[model samples]
Target chain A: MILAIASGKGGTGKTTVSVNLARAFDSEIQLLDCDVEEPNDHLFLKGAPTGREIIGIPVPEVDEALCDGCGECGRFCEYHAIVSFGTTPLVFPEMCHGCGGCTMVCPVKAIRETAKPIGAVETRRAGNVTLVQGRLDIGAAMAPPLIHAVKARLRRDLPAILDAPPGTSCPVIATLRGADFVLLVTEPTPFGLHDLTLAVEMVRALGIPFGVVVNRVGLGDDRVHRYCGQRHIPILLEIPDDRRIAEACSRGGLIVEALPEYRGLFRNLVGKTMFRTNPKEA
Target chain B: MKVAFTVSGGDLAAPLDSRFGRAPKFLVYDLDKETFEVVDNRQSLDAAQGAGIQSAETVARLGAKALVTGHCGPKAFRVLRAAGIGIHYAGEGTVAEALARYRAGELPEAAAPDVEGHWA
Candidate 1:
């Protein structure tokens, strides 16, 4: 089963949950960090990337010689990246979505496509889990495409744990695609509850079964718990607030590896998640 | 020579539209023939991005030699400048009042764009 660990708000311990859960699986499991804008899972994982690949999108390049400025490309382009004012076409590479419709609509064949680097995806083996991460270039708005590239390497034979980007927008929606089950990670606070409700609405609209994992459980009131109970959503696991866990995380150490005590907790969490996602197999 | 005035409506009595890209309409006035035409700028108004450049392209296509608006971003300014179209800045008022200012040579030529892109 492909389970995605997602959070509506940032810094709610999604990487901590994802990495720890991946370690719980003894078999060959895949871990895909779909947060291309800022992937931090590699910090806690061991080993260097065995394979590296750069990912790019095709942006339009115009030929001024064989062209009349019909303004057709500008009129046809929905993104407004390409436009012809007078007899010259101006292209903003940063705004191009790589749809290739501009080139196709060019009557004079003056528009051609060129590769524009968006980001890179690196693959490595970190103990029992194979970690794959997509890192986007700074100031690039192409995170969704690179995230797709990282997910394209999922191993069907093994269970894939996807760590999604924060929020309820394009990047988050892109990562949620094809996920068998979603694990919504959130803290038990007012902001957390507000964003979590939005996330729940998004997942429900996507029609994916999801459960909540409340991190730093005792730090806030039981509102998140109460909300979940009212909605009848399963509480997968609750990791208590502890300075020791924070200290380990700050030093880029896994909670399971440093404490050794929480290894079973994470393992049990994984098992419960698997059972919920696939009751027949469990 | 023809002059383009960004407007809120499609008539002479329409108020001047300060927004260059998202203006509802443009009045293309001919200096020689003393006739004018209104061009729909609703497409640029609804454009997701590059509204300025698209509107500038429309102005160029209509063969306007000058532009009268309250604001112009750097991108749209570049497009109009490259098309050899002169840009002038006018304050918020009726289109007829703006035209009177233009005819009386009260408006100043903008050396650079007055506002940033997507300000409207």
Candidate 2:
């Protein structure tokens, strides 16, 4: 089963939950951290990556010598990344989405497609789990393409867990796409509740079977539980505010390994996810 | 001058329709003329969620001289500025009230939205 762990807000212990869960599964399991922009799971995982691959996107490069600056490329680009008037054509790399529209519209073929390295995907062996992660290049605005690159390395036969980026944006959608189930992690706070609603809406829109994992459970209100109850979404696991766990996270350690007692919780989380994903498997 | 207003649906004056691309039933008033033109923004694309630049382009294409809205990001701000459109920030109350404030020149000119990513 491909399980995707996602949250709408940052700092919700998503990496912690993912690492611990991967450790608990412990047998040829694959963990793909699709949070390409700020991947931290590798910091907590075991040793250096065994494999690496660079991810790139094709962006248009204009050749000024070709001929007259007709401004057709600028007119065709909906992003306005390229704007030409009279004799000059301004190209803004940051605004470019790599749609290749400019190259197609240029009558003189002045625009050529060139690859720009956006990020890299690294695969590391963490005891039993194979961790695949994407690290975006600094100043790269686009993330979805890099996320797709990381996910493409997923091993189909083995169970995989995808740690998605925060929020209900395009990157999150790219990470959660094609997953059998999604685990929405959130804290029990007002901001957490608000963002959780957004995530829930997003998962529902994607039509993926989902459950909630309330992290730092005792630190805040029970609104999250009430919300889950009202919506009939299952509460898979709840990790309370434990100082030991925080320290372990700081030291790049998994909760299941640091505190042994939490192993069962993660195991149960996997069990619930499996049952929800495949009722016949139960 | 014709203008477009960008509003996230959660705003009080935001139209009842959830289709974000459609413009809410709001008016862009001309303070000099003392008259208002109810701008139909239904045809414009929504920028409230993702791709602010695209939304800014939609607003610009609508021939808006000024944009009134609650919040905008840096990328969208740059695009709007490049289009030569004035921006008004913290526009509250009903859409009409905000337009009145714009007409009265009471609302401060909005500074460019920060360019840092939303997560940061």
Candidate 3:
């Protein structure tokens, strides 16, 4: 079974919940961090990456010697990533989507594909947990592909826990796809509630079973509780407003390891989440 | 010489638009015939990205010798400059007034793009 942890609002402790849950699973597990733009799970874990691989997308490169500047490729490109002005088509690698449309449109076949590094995926083992994460190069617009690359490391026999990127856009969708259950982490603030509603809509649209995990619980008002009750959405877990946990997080310490007292709570969370997602398996 | 003036509407009396990439309309005025042709610019306005480059393509395809707009970004400026299309500065006024300024040599030729890419 695969469980995805996501949150619409940034800094809602989605990563905190995911990293701790993986530790309390009590079995061989794969922990994949799909927040390619800013992955921080490895920092919290206590092992060096055993493997790393670079990933990239193919962008167009124009060969001026092979042809005339017919401008056909320029006209056909919807992105206008390549523009021709009676000279070799000027190719902007950043803007190119690598659709191969420009190459097809070039009558002389002057356009060739070249790989541009977007990011890299690395794997590390923190005891029984196999952690895979994608780290995108700064300024790289594409994240879905790198997230897909990290997902490639999923160990099918073992249950996988995916920590999705914040928000309900393509990257989050890519991370949450094909999960057995989705756990949305949110704070109790009004901003958190707003983004959580949007995220709930996204999960419902995708036809996935989802539950809410309210982090920083006692600090905010009771609106989050009222909203969840009204919607009939279950609150799977609630991490109270604790300064010790915050300090542990700041010091790059795992909640399960630093505060062994909460180990039972995280364990119960995993058990309840599994049974909630699959009643028959319980 | 045909000059392209970015405007909010199709006529010479229309107000000049202070945008290049997403300008509502282009008034291509022919100096020899002293007449104007209008090109709708809604396509670039609705584009998700690359509006500046698409708008420059429109000016080049219309055979405009020069472009008069509020500002132009680096990418669009490169395309227009490479096509040998001179760019000039225009402010808030009627297209006819902008054309008069161009004829009188009052409009300064832009050495480089005045605004950043995709300002519109």
For residues A1-282, what per-residue lDDT tens digits would candidate 2 score against the true structure? 899999999899889989888888856788999999899998888776698888888887878789487879878876667766444466667667788888888888888888888989998887887889999999898999899889889889899999999999999999999999889999999999999999999988998888889999788899999999988888889998999999998888889988999899999887888546353221
Native contacts conserved, per model? 0.46, 0.00, 0.62
Restricting to chain A, the TM-score for each candidate equals 0.95, 0.93, 0.91
Every model's Cα RMSD, please?
Answer: 3.8, 7.8, 2.9
Residue A73's lDDT within candidate 2 is 82
lDDT of all predictions: 0.88, 0.77, 0.88
* lDDT against true structure, model 3: 0.88
Judging by lDDT, tell me the better candidate of 2 and 3.
3
Q: After superposition, how far is residue B40 of candidate 3 from its true place, in Å?
A: 4.6
TM-score of each: 0.83, 0.71, 0.88
Q: How well is candidate 1 docked (DockQ)?
A: 0.45
lDDT of 3 at A172: 96
Q: Can you list the residue pairs that collide in candidate 3?
A: none
List TM-scores of chain B, every candidate.
0.96, 0.64, 0.96
C-alpha lDDT (0 to 100) for residue A101 of candidate 1: 94
Candidate 3 CAPRI-style tier: medium
